[model samples]
Target: MSTAIAATSEIRFVLDHVAQIGHLAQSERFAAASDDVIEAIIEGAATFATEVWAPLNHAGDTVGAKWTEQGVVLPDRYPEAYRAYVEGGWGTIGVPEEHGGQGLPFTLQTAVLELLGTANPGFALCPTLTVGAIEALVHHGTPEQQAKFLPQLATGAWTGTMNLTEPQAGSDVGALRAQAVPRGDGTWSIKGTKIFISFGDHDLADNIVHLVLARTPDAPAGTRGISLFLVPKFRLDKEGHLGAFNDVKVVSIEHKLGLHASPTCVLSFGDNDDCVGELIGPEHGGMRAMFTMMNNARLNVGLQGVQIGEAATRKAVTYALERVQSARSGATDRKPVRIADHPDVRRMLMRMAAQTQAARALVYYAAAQVDRTTLGDAAARERLEILTPLAKAHATDLGNEIASIGVQVHGGMGYVEETGAAQYFRDARITPIYEGTNGIQAADLVGRKLGMGNGSAFASLIADMRETSQTAALTELIDVCDETGRRLAGADADDRLAASYPFLTMLSVAVCGWLMEAQGRAASDDDLWQAKKATTAFYLNQIVPEALGLAAAARASSAELYAVDPALLLA
Candidate 1:
């Protein structure tokens, strides 16, 4: 059986044909990124991912991260793998040129990230957070802050993290109690404990640049009063030299169900009352600044789903081809054949293939829109806003579902960890929960994104989907869009909120269907293209029709949901 995680040809096909990434290369912003250069970069990334990171995935999962008095200790291979990643300049691909980066298109970076996540998601988390931190600083940081942090972060000399969640606040940023007291000097003394801080402490880099959310002493209550702070693990002097410890410590690391190699730390700031931090943006502007990072992280997390699904699908296909099973119903020979020949097995495999490909197309398309925004397309920016939550929620949900099916494909052996199929399922389970839960994403789609410009953005998106083609799936999508628009327009906030999840799900399915159909129409006569066409057909015929039921559920009233008594549910 093949050990390959993803096919390079397929990635190239999607980039060129489905996402139309050439337009990015032609843009003045990314004029230096030619087709040859992009191809070479992708090939190099694939080599590093498959050769270096892929080998450590199982070991990292098994050994996980250990905590001692000193700090969180990762598996031995982690440091070496991360070092290779940095040395190869993988972290600088999408950063701006002024920051000592390669300045490639974000769409290209997204492609490379898919490879990294597939190879080892646990390892991928470190750089993923760093990239988000880089983005936040590039957009919102002061000149001094950018000068001090961007080079190190872009080159992976030091890693980065976002500190948001606290014991009192999980998803509700308004409830956080972290305090930032203004010191006599320009800096502020940060004091608080942050939970679920990914890569908060690690042995992989010289310092960890923590972008934390805290409240100022004179600020108002709730999220409106919060401010963003940049607190490094070690203090830096005027010359950008590392100085004394910043009084930030990791109290412990969480033993999680998956992505165990990535340390989720309980971080205490100013335990010794010496954790000084600089303001990232304006005072009382933390939410907006943090959203810049969170939005980027959300898109990356959504891609995580697609990555894991593709990896799991590859593994399942390989196993099915190797594992011997019963013959077909009208077999003349008594000997058993490969499980791939079985009808039920084929059904599962096709579902996995179609969903994974569809999710990839959806994510890559969104990334292209982000690139378009960089070229000053306001409409593309709005489209990205609407697509963000849908991509995150839908892709991650599919990742979990497809990984579960991968386990089933491996049958009894999949239950045993030695087969490696169980690992994909475990790793994918966290994508939907983190970077804002899928439930929150659904609500954001309904309550926020859909309502943008008095519902014009969503209406325009639906119109674009309708223009793609008039297949049954496309028609269903149009119907759902119209129905959702009507329901949301007529109902109060409560009714719309109740229908949010289903509406998001329905919308995602329709968008995926439209992209797949577009792929089908553009495919050539090549074998891979033919396979893509078949997968697109399967999605439209078998999978996409499910959106109709989702639309129905989304259009339903919230009365039944409210009718159930919470106390009686336990009985």
Candidate 2:
């Protein structure tokens, strides 16, 4: 199996040209992130990812994590790799300085995450969830909570998890039955069974903070009554030192298709009626507080899709260049040639490369918007609200598609587990399902995001996409957006629901086209620019046209969809 390599040059190019990391550095919030410092950080992270993390991917996948009477145990190399990750300050790159971090821009941190995720996503999840946890605490934690948890979490000494799902309530979070009762001592007793908790328990960190969602006795029904709580694996005494167990038990770790190194555990809280938790934010405000972490998590999840696609594309490209096959059809001499020379193979490779590049541009652009929000740009923040779901759903869908194409590029070798192509496919499958399924994302786009601030957010986005360039691709995108916006405006609730997924797809494809055009315009006469231009052409000519079909689908009414009986579906 070929090892996955980070495309440092491509990443640097996107960070500079598309995301405009320099402009972000000029912001008062990011004044410390000079260009040289950013470059050095990216380069250093790339080296660590390629050397320390990539080597453990295969071992982690094969050996997997283990569960025993003691607890969940990761593969041997993971501890050393995680230690190096913390020592290198990779986990603290984007955290605030007040929390014992270097305080770099989130855009730069996102780029670093791309490197780590591409190298090894299983290992990357620990830090990813921790960052989300830290963000939640920063926004909602009390001064005392911040004093006790923020520094350790920001420095990567303690990891975190978001506990939302239950056996009965997977996507329907309102259906959760986890119970929390006031202990009358500035804490609450929480009891529930949470499932599909990633990085729930690991030996790599001293403590694990779980942001749990549960209901109080007198709270209202459904989501509104739910509240967010901070539950640590180990209890802290008055002096803020780790003491006894907190009654958070890891029942078992899942045996999964991919990302075997990442332990997905079913956690049982308060099984012995001794679990204690502290409320975060306001009472009965779990949804709002959790969204703070979930929104950021959704964006990172989208980047995961981009990361896997990039890794798979690299593997496929390498394989095509080395594998020999029949000569070109027109050749008089009967000599073999690299499969990369075949026209069909070239098509497949181009699709993988182009789609991966476009997705990278979208993810980075979204991350930049996040950075802009920190700089106090209200418009940028609004734009992020619209871009979030599109980035998450579109990138993940492309990740799965591109990985399947990657397997096809490798032929029979891709089918066998040893070649590692199948692993990419397996790992990518979870992105769309978790982090709010793509279906939910699409619905959010059409139902909620489109209507934010009387539709000003999406309207401004379309206007910006139109103003970005005058290319034919952008023109097609503009038309699609205009039409979808029109359909959504007059759409009945049911009709809009039916068209939501296709509308999100069209919008995502159009955004990718706009970003590609931007890349082409920014290119110099160098070889990298030349390659960018060619990929842009391929994306515009081949991929952008899907928007027309999706737009048509988005225009379809719900009448036909609902005309079919529910009994027929079961039949």
Best by TM-score: 1
Worst 10 residues of 1 by lDDT: 1-10
Candidate 2, residue 189: Cα displacement in angstroms equals 0.7
lDDT of 2 by residue, 173-241 (tens): 999999999999989999999999999998898899999999999899999999999999998898888
lDDT of each: 0.90, 0.90
Model 1 segments more than 4 A misplaced = none
Worst 10 residues of 2 by lDDT: 1-10
Clashing pairs in 1: none
Candidate 1 lDDT over residue span 393-480, tens digit each: 9999999999999999999999999998999999999999998999999888877888788888888888888876668766866777
Clashes of each: 0, 0
Error of 1 at 307 (Å): 1.1
